[model samples]
Target chain A: MNRLTALVIAFALLLFAPARALDIQLTSGDWQPINIFVELFLGEENLNGQIPSDIIADDLTVSGNFRAYKENQNHANAMSAERLGDIRNRGGEYLITGTVNNKSGKQYTLSFTLYDTLTNDKIGSYSIVFNNENQRLVAHNVSNWIYETILSKAGIFHTKVAYVVRHEDGTNELKVADYDGHNRLVMLTSQDHIISPTWTANGNSLLYVSFEQNKPVIYQQSLLTGERSIVANFKGSNSAPAASPDNRTIAAALTEHGGLQQIYLLSGNRKARLRESKGIDTEPVFSPDSKHLAFISDESGSPQIYQFNLDDNKTRRLTFGSRYNVSPDYSAQGDVLTLVRRDENGDNISILDIRNGDTIPLTNTASTNSPSFAPNGDVISFIDDRNKKNLATVSVNGKVIVFWRDSEQGEIINPSWSPIKSDWF
Target chain B: MKKQNFASLATIFFALVLTGCAASKGAYSGNIEDDRSGEAGLAPVSAGTAGKASSPGFVKSSTIDDERTSTDSLLQKRIIYFDYDKSAVRDEALPILHTHAEFLNNKGGAIGIVLGGHADNRGSNEYNLALGQRRANAVRDIFLSYGASANDIEAISFGEEQPRAQGDNESAWQENRRVEIRYTDE
Candidate 1:
């Protein structure tokens, strides 16, 4: 019998049976926590459906809800309508079933359906036809749809991530791609080396370090035009270039005379020294108001993040939990600051609430570095090297979604999210 | 009483051995006894050679060759200092530059020389790399004007990666802000 007909017959049988005390007890209690099981079938056959099922489970768990279960055996033949009724009676609130078929060449067709276990009725259905390379993204969109249908909130499945990928020979390149590792593009390529790619106020341009001329110089590049130029040139070294919220000015760490590296402001051809410290001060980031700067310095004999007031030129230390805290990025709302904190154990990403200065750990998974915030400031993108390869983009709650996942390609590191989409040609 | 005397002798022997090892390695060499020969009129030697002389007890005679000895002697007679953030041979470095120029003019042909420029690690690595290249180029230009062939010289910048001192103080930075001239041939 067809799967739908079998499910209907099973539901009729369960309805005819008398309601037992156990059945009532199972149906009560907050709907049994809603476990959604997604299976992928390819052209009337099953082709390693467990992998995609596991990926969906991981994405759903990011919400801190949902207990997803995957049946070990292929259910394409064994799961009859009676089994569906039994699952419904056992408190499995929702069931998601899908099929993946390889069309011509790299093309693929994925069919999915979501069913309400309580009534054994089909709630929604979706069909995605795409290339094999886009399979992960299709899964991401499917997960997002499932999330929205259940929670009434929009999903971030379609968002892109930007990061720096460096080779063992010290060749650094900037890359941007979909969060699930599709449509990868190289933003900046240099033979010398590149570090710390930061997105402009609008996501159209990126500001980063390039050693094309044999020194650490900051450059701003247009993503569309592929044209780049030096933004600031200082005598000793220039690094950690961060654009302000208004895009009117840039804040960078510049070494002057014989003093320590300090924060400086750049506007056209004019340069203004913002802070004068006797210790090593570097890694400058600006607040949304552009009136204050956050940076890392070794003035205390160890690296720590500090905040400097623009109007009065006063400075204050922002991080107190660790002796080594560097690469601080302020949120768009100006309420949260994300930074990489390192101690004796290892490095991890932590978020600091500006209102109360309470620091919280975001990634306890592995050695996390280079944390950058999305335009909305709700999710954070960072590089995690625990899996042997430098994979980028770990969610604020430590759910790592790999960007550009083809194993044949090199690794990705140091992600900087653009403030907004760029209009520059 | 006999045991006490033996302990004192052993202590003395150990102290002698420690002193022997310290002198043999020649690690401490910053002591000078002044004997005025009324040679105050002599030009003050450059800091590079002065540093070498102050630590004479540490450096062995085998490492001091005739060419290096002569260069050290000449460097003492002339001082070269660059302008702030500039690699161009400043007027202050003219005396030393002229000395090297005359030497290259006299010797000539097939000599390979390297100009190593360094920064104080104040800026980003990229900017410092460029600044260091500029400094080396400046010295190369001066050497060329003084009769050194372009084929015989090469310039490279280290861009604040290596420093002479390890502290964040100004004195340490001043010492690190420099370029070294190295010649592979006499």
Candidate 2:
């Protein structure tokens, strides 16, 4: 009789398994970043021993939740038992070790493993192949996989940040780089300025505003093929381009020949303008759910952040404290919007909670704008002019902030992080 | 003695009022001119080559002629100042508007000007662009009222992107919040 009942329950579960799969939630929970330690790899010939380990350490540190420490010795492979004792003695909960082999030409292979020293077991092991040019990226992939295995969360190691850099010649160039600001590639350079770049959902294309045609025109550039086409070139001015989370719609701020700047939604050739007062409406960033748009409007008086609802065609004010709250960007969870708030001193970064309408100050440093969330929503990348206009990232919940700069490259501004797709990992 | 003193004081006050020598013209409103030394100057009540320090030769060529120096001096004033967060045309901007309007009307359709409006870096870039455009439109409206055809001028706003002065102080902000009357490069 016990066996018969167990068989019946198993059959019911098998029948309802599709429903369970359908109801699986894609959301992750609020958790704190953990500290992890990475041991140096054994092989130094492929690209030198420390390059891959340093890249992994940098990626982990930038993730906001992890503080990675390097052991100085490459002894995790041969003496696993002794190394485990050493890591435990050093107060490390987890240890990462890897080996590299140089193959023909630019081809190389990495065999990295993450160990749970507390449990005395291997948590993750990856065998990845990359050319010499992408060896560092392969190490980042190893870091991300370890993060996924440990935290049950998607890692941002493979993500890239797109931003605009102003050259000394007064020209602007769009470039993409590793999340840690390593291995940058310039996409387009123009005689005029480019501002407000947004990555599409698929991460294959980017929407940006360029003044190359002597006007603020929005263009969609394919990152793979380098083909460019104007998405929004109105009669007067077009700028502040952003893509919806669903990737089915595009939103941007546009002005006609003699009109006020207003937010408009586009789906192919069909377009509809959202209702806004005579206020100067611009910089419409779509919420992750695509239900509301957060934009900067000066309708009530000075420029303040306001949200527009697509369902009801109504706009509500989000910020009331600062008179100058602009350049807003919504977080990945759609619960917070980071924007620039101006006080008597200078512009500072501030975060606004959508639930209670309460705001918290992010940075006391002046001369910062365009605060964008990291793909994981655990970090934010903003343009920091505190030290000559470099790309800066800050942990969302922590005080750990890092700045990436190339002095030869002029002022860097307006950084946009790619979104994390369900299948990204 | 008290009555005599009262009568004498009234006489002195009335004489001073009638003679128009009580207060200087620029004591209160002239502080902004000092803040705008390197910028294009506004037309002044008195003509002593007031705005020549910054006005380009293109603006001074026709206005510096000897015959119409009075009106030409007004035309030399090319910068229009706006109140903070307010794009409406103010009374102080009227004289400069009249100067540019007269310049446009008298120059026929031969001269075209682009009214590029700008704002300080206190607001969002695109909203500032619209506010700057509102200012440009305000100038354009006043110019149209003064007999300049619509085609003679185009209104554009660079917003806060191209600031005339780069600083965090009030003086720099005052100089940056303006609408410049630029002659078309053509």
Task: Tell me, by DockQ, which candidate is best.
Answer: 2
lDDT of 1 by residue, B33-113 (tens): 121122222111111111111110111234424443574545334323345456566676766766766665564542445
**Candidates, DockQ:** 0.02, 0.05
Query: How well is each residue in A1-425 modelled by candidate 2, as lDDT tens digits?
Result: 53344335434544553211011111133534454667667773435222787677667766666756665566546747667766655556778887777777768777877878777788778778877756756787787787788877888877888887777777667877666665555666665667778898788778987655334567786565444556875544677888988888898877654667788888898878877568778888888888999998777778888888889978889888667888888887899988888877778888889889988777777677778887778778887565655778777764567776634558886788877642322
Question: How many angstroms is residue A152 displaced in model 2 relative to the true structure, after the best TM-score fit?
Answer: 1.9
Interface RMS for model 2 = 22.6
Best by TM-score: 2
Worst ten-residue run, lDDT, model 2 chain A? A18-27
Worst 10 residues of 2 chain B by lDDT: B48-57
Residue-level error in angstroms, candidate 1, position B135: 17
TM-score of each: 0.56, 0.76
lDDT tens per residue, model 1, A1-425: 33354345435644663321111111112322345554444343212222455556546643334545553334543445675676566556677776777778868787777777777777788888876545666777888888789877655555556666655554555666554444455655544456667877766677876545434557776555444556754433567788888888988776534234567789888888876666656778888888888887666766778888878978888888676677788876788899877756667788888778888777665477778776556567666665524444544544333333423345565666655445631
Candidate 2, after superposition: displacement of residue A6 in Å?
51
How much DockQ does model 2 earn?
0.05
Best by lDDT: 2
